[model samples]
Target: MRSVLVTGGAGFIGANLVLELQNRYPDAWIVVVDDFRSGHFSNLEGFRGDCIASNVAELRLSERFRDGTFDAIFHLASITDTTDHDQLRQVRDNVESFRMLLNWASRDQTPVVYASSAATYGKAQSVMTEATDASPQNVYAFSKVQLDNLARYYHQQHPAWKIVGLRYFNVYGPREAHKGHASSMIFQLFQQMAAGKRPRIFTDGEQRRDFVYVKDVVAATLAALMAPDSRIYNIGSGASASFNQIVAGLNKALGTQLEPDYFENPYPFYQNFTEADISLARKELEYQPAFDLDRGIHDYVDWLQKERSS
Candidate 1:
């Protein structure tokens, strides 16, 4: 059986990716690692695989480091919560864990396909291409940029190691229950509307994002894993939508005419009027996002309703 290790397999994207892999590669031996610090056990419900609830950095110190060999490693574990963590903590947890994984992967010569963030392209005037115009706005983005730099360094230093860093846009979908403050606007809107409340949107609801669905993100990740090349790719729909558009979509899906409560933008945030140039991924990985914003929002809202009812 093909063996793979997903570092944050119990979190939002990780859990969805695990389910997708299980369906696609039935005989694959999937090992999931999550600390449950922010990840939830409920996300792994009905999953049929080996699961280890532990920190990735701690796992690097164990005997499994020598015994296990994986066809590919998906490093998704990180301090993704922008508000809950400070810069130093984000670096320590994210950069340090990634460093340990890279060190081990380099020694084992194992292929790594990891999650990078669109936040790395913070406040870029134009679309974020493959170039190194990384204006990271926050700790989370800074950590991801650090990983991308590390991947580039490793690829240059050790030509044998295959590493692909996927710069993921705003990802949203089912099984993302623990996302809390970091959850997508769609999910948050669903929850608010369900409770008969209008969802609050920030910054006059004008800030835009390249909101890629979780399934598409997983497909891109899998493609990166199977691809032979070692390069950074932007995984997004290449289309942009404002917060107003998202709220409108959700209202349509839920059959309600609720308006969003507008608020001032919080934090020293990157008001990202951003879209991905997914040309490289299209040319190389044959990756194209299948879901549009309205369709994705409808599907997510339906799932959220069912999940909440259950």
Candidate 2:
């Protein structure tokens, strides 16, 4: 059986990717490592694997991975709360864990595919390309930026091994309810409407994002695993959608007419607009996002309603 290690395998995106990998590689032996700091074990319900309950920071390379060789390492473990005020903890938990991964990769020469964030771009201009200057507005984003830079440095030092970084934009889909405040606007709006309440949004709900679905993100990441070259690729729908659009999409999908309660956004730093220049991802990873905002929200709400009913 093919062996693969998925860090953060109990989290939102990681759980989805694990299911996909199981479907793609039916006989593969998957090792899931999750500390459950943010991820929920319910996310891994019915999953069949040897799950190691440990943090990447506290892992021993000789003892943990000495017996087996993995085809790829999906490094999704990190402190992703963008509103976190603790910068030192962000570095200690996120950057330090990534350093451990880099150390293992350096010795094992395994392909390391990590989850980078479009948060690295901050409130900069939209339609950002890979070459665009990164202006991280939060500690979490800064941590990701540090990891991306470190990935590049590792790639340079170990050119023979493939280390891919995917800069994901605003993503939403199934299995994200555990994220709570960190969940996507699409999910949050559906919750409000499902509860027969108005959706709460920031300002006029005009803040836009390149809301790519989870399916697309996983597909793109899978493609990147087979990519001939290693580098950072922007994983997002090359289009932007306003929060108002998400509200509308949810209402339409849920068969309810609900208006959004727009309040003043109090955050000092907010990303008002984000649209990825996905030309690089398309050319390199052969990745094309399958879901736009309207369709993605519709599908998500449909599944969510069924889940709730079941």
Candidate 3:
């Protein structure tokens, strides 16, 4: 824990993790690596670490990470946009960049905790677990699945290194202002409400999603440093909340009772429901989600209002 690396450290979850890392390990020499593809430098307004503004694939080219430089690496950089259409770029950037980082980690024998996704579960509605079959429906999800597969291959090749992957569910919270259209529905709804507009929803807004707050996601991610083993685990609330509930929560938080305007969902490949079965994560990582939908919404709205003022 003396030296840590957080790729995509300016992203929503990574930025929050950076803050938490500083708070927890005051003496750790933290380094943030990002290409600014979707991450915002403003997100690291108070970050104290060194930054390498490059893709993980270019880490070696940039001549960083010589050897035993990073005690642990939080690999959150990837093609996170689920709607990305370029299949080749998605695989190249997400999977190849990760392969580069995995090679670096293997060479250094450093522990790595990387970001996986719920997208691997695709249309599966049953409780999501580590054992669930991967059914990726898009190129982005496919890239994540490939990353997981690569990690498994490398883990078998290098048995002693800790290479854990966290399959994050619908994470939403602070430092996500730059996600734009890719931001979560919670942030999108809050923005519409703050702008004195009705929240927009597709259809009946009954489609459920397990929206785990960014704080909880960061905690679960960091827990892998002390986790029992290096394996993929779901980091989520283990509870599903509908879009209707999200609108309701926002209304209560913003003190604006605005009914949602229903519209048809444009995308054909949409997950109707997702609820993570976090029992194994709970037992293994000792990770528990503290912010329910309502609580997380409250915290998010508070930050939103402050952002407006600042």
Give the number of the best model, judged by lDDT: 3
Which of 1 and 3 is the better model by TM-score?
A: 3
Write down the RMSD of all candidates, one decimal each: 1.5, 1.0, 1.2
Residue pairs with backbone atoms closer than 3 Å in model 3 (clashes) = none
Model 3 residue 256 lDDT score: 91
Candidate 3 per-residue lDDT over residues 231-258, each given as its tens digit: 9999999999999999999999989999
Writing each residue's lDDT as its tens digit, candidate 1 over 84-138 gives 5587888888988888888888877789989998888888767879884898888
> C-alpha displacement of 229 in model 2, angstroms?
1.5
**In candidate 2, what are the lDDT values of residues 130-151, reduced to their tens digit?**
8889998888989999999899
Q: What ranges in model 2 sit over 4 Å off?
A: none
The positional error of residue 285 in candidate 3, measured at the CA in angstroms, is: 1.0
Once model 3 is optimally superposed onto the true structure by TM-score, how far is the C-alpha of residue 109 displaced, in angstroms?
A: 1.5
Please list all clashing residue pairs in model 1, or write none if there are none.
Answer: none
Displacement of residue 157 (Cα, Å) in model 2 is 1.0
